[model samples]
Target: MTSSLQAALDPSAIAVIGASENPDKIGGRPLLYLSMFGFRGEVWPVNPKRDEVQGRRTVPRLSALSRAPDLAIIAVPGEAAVAALDECGEVGVKVAIMMASGFGETADPAAQAAERAMVARARARGVRMIGPNSQGLANFGTGAVPSFSSMFLEVPPQDGPVGIVSQSGAMSVVPYGLLRGRGIGVRHTHATGNDADVTVCELAAAVAADPALKLLLLYLESIPDPHHLAEAAAIARDRGLPIVALKSGRTAAGQAAAQSHTGALANEDRLVDAFLERHGIWRADDTTDLVAAAELYLKGWRPGGRRMVAISNSGATCVMAADAASAAGLDLTP
Candidate 1:
C-alpha cells in the first residue's frame, strides 16, 4: 500500500486553497490555528481573489507558487472544489483534504454526479482526496494544521506516542485535545472524511507501522469495508499495539444518521463487537471509556486476560471502577 507519492511529500508544507480574510469562514480557521500554534512550516494561501490572508501573501493559484506544497487543504465552495483540485493535481499536490460539502448529501442529482466526477478525476491523477464533505485532516506529528475548525485554535503541537485515526473530523480534534490535556502524547492524527481514497483501514495500517506510535484511538461511525478493517486490526494486534475503538451508530436511529452523513452503512453492531474482541481490540462505549482505555494502554497497563486489579481511595470509587470495567466487558478481579 506504500507509494512513492506518500513518501516524497514532506507532509509539512501545506497550502490552503480557499484561504479567506474572514476568520469566521472555513478556510480562515486553519490559517488562524496554524499561525497561532506556530506551525514550523511554510503555510501558503492559494486564493486568486485575495492578495493576502491572515497577514500572509496569498498566491493567485497553486500553479503560480514557487514551491510545490506537500499537501493542499480545499475549503472552497462545492462547485469550485474540483477546479481547485485540478490546480492541485497540476502542481503535484500529494494529499488533499476537501472540506467542501454538497456532494452525496445534496437533494439534486446533478450535484451528486458532479461530486463523483470530481473524485474520479482526482483519483485518475493519482491525487488522494480525503473528503468532499469533511471537516478536514490534521497531522500533529508533522505540525500540519489542515483542519479549519476553531477547536484547534487552543491546541499546541505536541508529538507523543499515540496516533488517532478518526472518521469524524469533530471527534478528532476534541479527542486529541482531551488526550493531550491529560498528558497523553499523540504522534499523528487524521480525520478521514468521505474516505474517497484513503480509508480508515489504510490509515490504521500506516499508523501501525509508525515506530513512534504505541497506541491508536479510533472514532468510527461505521466500517465501510470490514475485510480491510479486519486486516488492519490483525496487523495492529501482531505488533502488540492496542487499539481502542469507539464505534458510533449503534442504534437504529444513529445508524440512519451515520448513513446520511457519509453514505455508508453501519455494520451490524454485534458483528463489529465480536470482530473487535477476536482481534484483541478494546471497544469503548462512551467518551470517558474511550479516553480511559487509551490512557491506560498508553501508560503500559494491560490486563493479563480480562481480569484486572482495582485500587481506589474510596469504596464508592472502587465499586464504580469495578462496575465500569465489567460494563466494558473486562473482568475486575482482586
Candidate 2:
C-alpha cells in the first residue's frame, strides 16, 4: 500500500470541507461520528458560510489551516467537490474522502468526463481520493470514523479482529453490523464508492496488512484491479488471515444493476471464482455467507481435510447435514 493511503487509515488530523452545523447532513455526519466515537485527533471544519460547525470553530477555507491535514473529507456537491479536491491537493493533504456524487455512476458523458478530469487533477497533485459518492471509512481501533454510515450509530463499535472492505458503502457496513450483532468485534470498515480513485482491492490490501486483523470480509461489484486483490490475498495468506469475498453481478439482472449502481463492468464470474481460489480467498454467495464463518475463522480453526461428520439431536437434522456436506464436496464418513 502507498504511504499516503496508509496514513489515511490512521490520520492524526482531519479537515472537513464544506462542513455543516447540522449533524444529520452529509457534511455534518462525519463530525457527529467522529465526536460520538471519540476520535483523539485534530479536526478542522472548513465552511466559508459558518463560523462554527457543531460547536467547533471553523476555518473559512483549507488555506487557512496552520498545516495541511493528514486527511481531508470533501463533503460538498458537484463541481464544488472538485474544487475542494484541488484545494486539498494544493494544500498537501495526504488523502481525501470525497462524499459527493454526480460522477461516472450516472453514466452520463459529461459526468464521466468530469470524473476523469477530477481524477487527473488529484493525480497531478498527488492526492488519493476515496470516492466521489462514498459513505466513507471507519477505524474503531483509532476512532477514526470518517464515514457517515448510520450503522455505526445503530450498532455501536468495539475494537475487534475483523476488517471489512467493499466497493459499495452499504455492503461495507452491513457486514460490520452482522459481525457486531454476532458478538464479533470489527476494527475497520471502509467503502470505496464508485471506485473513482481507490478500488476495493487496493483498500483490501491495506486492511489485510493490519496485524491485528484475523478475518477480512469483502464485497466487490467489480474487479477493476485484480493485481491488488491478488496482492491482498497473498498478504493475508502469508499472515494466516482468512478473506471471504462476496463478488456480486453473477447473473444478467445483477450484472445490469452493478453497472448502473457503480458504473462497474462485470468480470466474468467463472474467471473471478478461479482467480479468488488461486489466491486462497474464499468466495461467498451472499452477505450471510460472507460472515457466516467469521467466528470459526477468528477462533483459528484449520480443517485438515474436506471431510465431515454430522452430529445432531435429531436424525432428520443429521440427514440434512450429511446432504449439505455432500453437496459442498465434503466427504461424509461414519
Which candidate has the top score in lDDT? 2
Residues 20-45 of candidate 2 have per-residue lDDT tens digits of 88887888999998898889999999
Candidate 1: segments with Cα more than 4 A from true spot:
1-12, 106-108, 155-157, 305-334
Error of 2 at 211 (Å): 1.1
lDDT of 1 by residue, 61-173 (tens): 88888877878889998668889988777878877888887776555678678867877887777778777777765556655666776666676657788888887777777
TM-score of each model, paired residue for residue: 0.85, 0.95
| Model 1, residue pairs in steric clash | none
lDDT of each: 0.76, 0.90
lDDT (Cα) of model 2: 0.90
Stretch of 10 with least lDDT, candidate 2: 325-334
TM-score of 1: 0.85
